[model samples]
Target: MTRQPFPRLKASAAALLLFGMGALAPGAQAKEAAPLRPQVAAPLSSFDAEVNTFLAAYWRMFPDAAVAAGRYAEAARLPAPTEALRKQQLAFAEQWLQRLAGLNKNTGLSAAQAGDLLLLDNHLQALRWSLTELRSDRWDPTEYNVADPFAQLLNKPDFAPLPQRLKLMDQRLRQVPAYYQAALAKLSEPSPLHLKLAIEQNSGALSLFRDDIPRAIKQAGLKPAEAAAITAHNAKALSALEEFIAGLQKIEKAQAGAGRSFRLGKALFEQKFAYEIQASVDAQTLYQRALAEKEALLQRMSAYADQLWPQCLAGEAVPADRSDKIARVIAKLSERHVAPERFVEDIKAQIPALEKWVVEHDLLTLDPSRPLVVRETPTYMRGVAGASISAPGLMDPKGVTYYNVDPLDKYTPEQAESFLREYNHWVLQVLNIHEAIPGHYVQLLYSNKSPSKVKALFGNGAMVEGWAVYAERMMMESGWGAVDGKPSAEMGLMYAKWNLRVVSNAILDYSVHVLGMSEAEAMNLLQREAFQSHTEATEKWHRAQVSSTQLSSYFAGFSEILALREALKAKQGSDFKLKAFHEEFLSHGSAPVRMVQKLMLGQ
Candidate 1:
């Protein structure tokens, strides 16, 4: 098996959004754009050279990753860069930004060519903001000698050999001091709340350090020298770390978990809202729209339930009871749909069918770069029900994409049965389309080799989420959806009903945490609006109280993607190809759905 090289470059979320808008490029405005069409695209970009250079420079910077990235046995022996070298790299970021800013993006080109430039511009813009403005020298507070990824980086068996990857950890660990100092040097006045949250966020990490370090050392099979070195460094870092922790704790105690919420002051709020929508849309206004939409969807879903689930009866349809039915059906279908069992098996079984399906379908342009393996979520992260597709992180030229289903076995057997029955084969199949094939993976795989180095690292969340949700609707229209090709119109309403629920998902986090809505209040809104199960509502309530900006990423992303698709259809006119358009939409790179929308439309 060949190794997938490490992703050397750092990308902000904006760069990623541009790449995600590859074909669309965000500016082509059209009406009634093709929906339910499979999005297979012609392969158009490569990041091999850029990725190789970035990885090489990055490995030079964080040698500990060599082991995790399959480049070395241990970073223990690697020479740690002196403070001089650290300064040199920071300078390099500045020079790179300058160099990037000088590129001539507007050399007469095709519509696609212009879109690529937009991605390029956005990428450089984010790099300038992060490297120069934000100046986040190290990833953040703690440095680990061992590569335990709690972020975008992950474990891919083929990325690098384990021993080689391990070799870089020591070097990375040694740089912790340097990174912390860099963060301090670059630290600007706190954004009032983010600073506080950043501090409070460390609390969990302190416990993690106290518990996770020794285990990591053992798991990594440390030599006495390596072990001793880690222990000594841990001790020294811990002293300073504890001081930092104490300071943070003091601030946090004063705020009482309030500062960490999502109350973006008008200035920050507008910036966030703009980046989120990927078009000219306001966050607060969009949220109000969501609230209204949520009400309508609840009514529609309830009505659909009464008709489809006749047992809901003529008298007194208890929403709690009815909601249980909705959850139960979704849950049951979901239960039977194991990542290892139903999903993977279906992918394999459909190889023959898909071959024919693609050829016969007449809308998609399947690329050979696609090599999929469906699997159950890894043992570590199974708690989140529902599945997700992770596009290749540091493996393969085209990162390996996984259609990960949350295994039902973790639930009680009875729960499992209900889960399976509720989720149903149709819902599971639709979810597959949403996560894999012509959805997230398809979009992300195209995004993997974006020309903009800036975007590869910092792709935004809205585009990622919007495309997947949009695909749900698109797939339903195409015959390649649901277990049964022809689901009843009620199920169609079910899909739309769920689509409207995202509005609540979008703002609930802000409402509860930032708006100071209590869980009881939040739960009531969610229950009344989303028709969510108590369990689901409660889960979201917890998620809302702690998380601030992320829940908004989804709906905002979807709207921007849809907007771009419409624009592209209008610009491309009668000649537009859904397959080609989708492929192109994600090819440019990821950026905020709005920032890249102009590019998506080739404006």
Candidate 2:
């Protein structure tokens, strides 16, 4: 899973004016003022001005995001997730969306500005949909994961003198009680799963306060009195958080159906898929596409398994059943995994090898100066995904990016083995390619160089995830892990299995969220179809419930990006270069593929 920035609340005016007033007024007069000129003919400068105006307002509404994005002028503050703040954000979105709609699209916008317009429109629509339709603050207790903001503030060394940064953090720490209080007031009819997760996650936050905060305080070398004051505030906040978790546990005990339904159903799921993915197709189309891809991937895995069966089994008779053959071959290969204790270290070791391969293959350019640190996953962020890349935000260029891997030490022997088997040696390489190397870490590092901070701040998840999945395949296709300059069938088979996981991720997300697939069916899909272990499947089920449309991102993005590459290859013919294609694709920041394609191809 990709690590997302904490959600920032964007406030707006309480009252929504008529559509044709304010920013829309000038836009509405476009036809009358310049009757013959197309909106596309408008000066590029005008489009840039409009973009600036919109972003200025956006930063005002989401100062927390501004601060996170490295806009110190906005103030170092945490978002106020109060009901009034929600209403304000919704109103702001509606106003801007209408204003954007009123803009002349036929004359003035340059290709880049047009792309930005599409992105901004989708962003506003998504915000509105999230507030009105999803209403996460009301039912999803995980929305109150306060630890992320505080931790983010402390972790990044970008701000200033240690004391100044600590001062800002202390202010945020003091606000934590009110944040949780607002959360308590807003939340109602929460899902049991959400409540449980919130309790566990908040407990993790308490640990952060008890452990990491004190360490950070000492590291900063704050004055004793200042440190004592901060510690007092942190203690108070921790007590409030503990009290809140206890209250949630009490609610869980009292209510039979404690949590609200996690399902988005067909309609809401379609809307979310459209806006979140910004894809050309609808949810049903994407689901069908995923199903076909799953079948195709499984077939490919079966073909590889057929060839490897004799070798893997070491003269043991191959299973007669085709399904059994595939599963057996995978299990045999998984035996080559790292020990549980060495999992994180082993992952770290794979980085340089992958980087060397990328550079040797001339797959993409690398920036040596960008610092990427491999670390254990933070406690609050654990239990959702095994590994994730937490890249530096656009604003914090000097900040270190973390490749967080959840260690296997905490799991039972059986569970740990299952996790290990899922991330077997070969597959782990593919994962490192996806999460680091030429995937998120590299992609995000390039993104920070983008001139458009708007796109950087409001990145498209599909594009981000899709690029990573594409990187996995790209590395393999470029002859990665070839032994003695000869292609290894074992590596190829493992890569195919990893692709199966990607396909299965999309299928599981849609099935669970839209079709309401049961645990038994979901497990069968992951374990049997996707070749995942029981432990991996269980966590994926939880992830699918908590997140919608995200799991599908890898497939949706991979498909779109691949299609773009193929099209470019055909168009450019002999002139087509892989490295150029990769650089150009990522150059557009993390906008939706459609917009990126439009800008790149000049469509």
Candidate 3:
């Protein structure tokens, strides 16, 4: 299945009592053994049973999601995304939300139980919000893309016996036409940007089925007839998808020059931001903080540029404008990147070195057995990102995690150069640190070990992205690329520029969706202030138009995690251990930083 995007807090007087023990501390074994405490255990057990029942029913509603999460039951088949299914999902969420509300939060609950309860509530709220407020089924054509389920099932080693998985793929493939029909009936007044993305993505889906499916079938060693039948089914599905695309194109042509609104506006943006970020603050607060942080980062970037200006200019006249000066220094640094053809392989080369660094430094513990593979981004999943990690679900921890990097072969030389310049050699290391190494790859392996599947399956995006961003900084601070005995100043400079990109992502997301920022203003913000290349700026503009709130997660989450670390250090004083802090911080699965804080700090 398409990997979900994966989110902070404080020390108080209760913090000492809570964080004094590690996050994985046994829930007072002495108390659990006491005869009288059975009363306490009974209610907690009841809560677990109730929540488990709810989840089973809920997963049945989205069987494809279940399969993606590593559940391989026969019931875990793709369901048609019909309006009836949507209504049923909405009613199911509402019904469970009420039933869960009947459970008392104040009494007879273990810490783990309380945390899981919080997760279930958040999950339900998010489901309700998506169905009722977001209404993606009505307007977002990308929601109907049928290629991902089949691709994920076939591509990943989730099922045993190739034929079993292929049969499941066949089942989903035959239902594609019905799914498309449902989508056609549901989608109306679609956003222009979303429509364009959906078209590109569906076209990529065609490529995926045509080019990738046969290879997968061959690898699976299916019988000749089985392979033929699977091929025919996929061909039919692709044809239906093409017809759906034609329908979408008609809609696009009819609405030409009459740009449908992409903005979520102020109210919806805040609500979605709250649900997605799951932080204490609202969207406006985060936006204002991002603005302030951007200015601070600019000053830091200027100092770093000043240090490198003499070297970069080689005695050429310095620019009078400070922003121009910083840009010049960064441009010089970006000159060291790999060529377009070598991009994917170069990224692959960095992973092992980074893993070595983490191991030598005793940065969080590494799992030698859990495999992480670097591969080209799958066709259908591209257009939105340069790279991403498709992590194994908690239920299927043994599954291979794919770190997908988009290739630069498709772009013209000028475009590819612009893209490469933005992701230079030093920045590439930092990017690897974020997407692989001790970033998404490492964080996710740990996530699979989380005691609570609720937190793992419904992880907070802010926390996930935040940890990756934070990991980039953590590695740099720990002297990741030291030359001889000295740390690499060039790496530090690249990191600062990358952090600026993170902050600007928040600004751009809020501006396009809520502030209604003009193209010129957004471009200037990304290019001039954030030091992004023209190509990167242009794509980010499209990303901002097609998505909302998600761009802000990196900054919002990184900020919260940083604050939590500082608080922990201050509370622990000399007792603080970086390894312990990391292990503890990540122990809560991918729950909101606030929930983690409560669990860790006894709040």
Better of 1 and 3 by TM-score: 3
Tens-place lDDT per residue, model 3, 401-422, is: 8888888887899999999999
lDDT of 3: 0.74
Q: Model 2 over residues 1-603: C-alpha lDDT tens digits?
A: 554432222122111111101111112222222322223456767667877898788777876556556655444455557888888888898999888876644446555555556567656766776678767677777767567656766665666666777787788778777777777887788888878887887787788788887778888887799999988987887887887888788878887764689887877676667666656566677888989987787788788888887788877877777678899988988998999999889988888888888999999999988877999988887757778887766767787888998888789999999889888888888889999989989988887887765566676777888899999889878988789988888898888878887888888888988889999999899887777889988999898877777787788888999999998889899999999999988888777786677666655
Candidate 1, residues 75-191, lDDT tens digits: the string is 343332333544555565565445433433223333333333334444344333334333222322222112233222224335444433344444444544544343444333323
**Residue 332, candidate 1: C-alpha displacement in angstroms:** 11
Q: In order, what is each prediction's RMSD in angstroms? A: 8.5, 5.0, 7.0
Superposed by TM-score, candidate 1 places the C-alpha of residue 425 at a distance from the truth, in angstroms, of 5.6
Candidate 2 displacement at residue 51 in angstroms: 3.0
Window of ten residues with lowest summed lDDT in model 1: 1-10
Decide which is better by lDDT, 1 or 2.
2
Model 1 accuracy (lDDT, Cα): 0.48
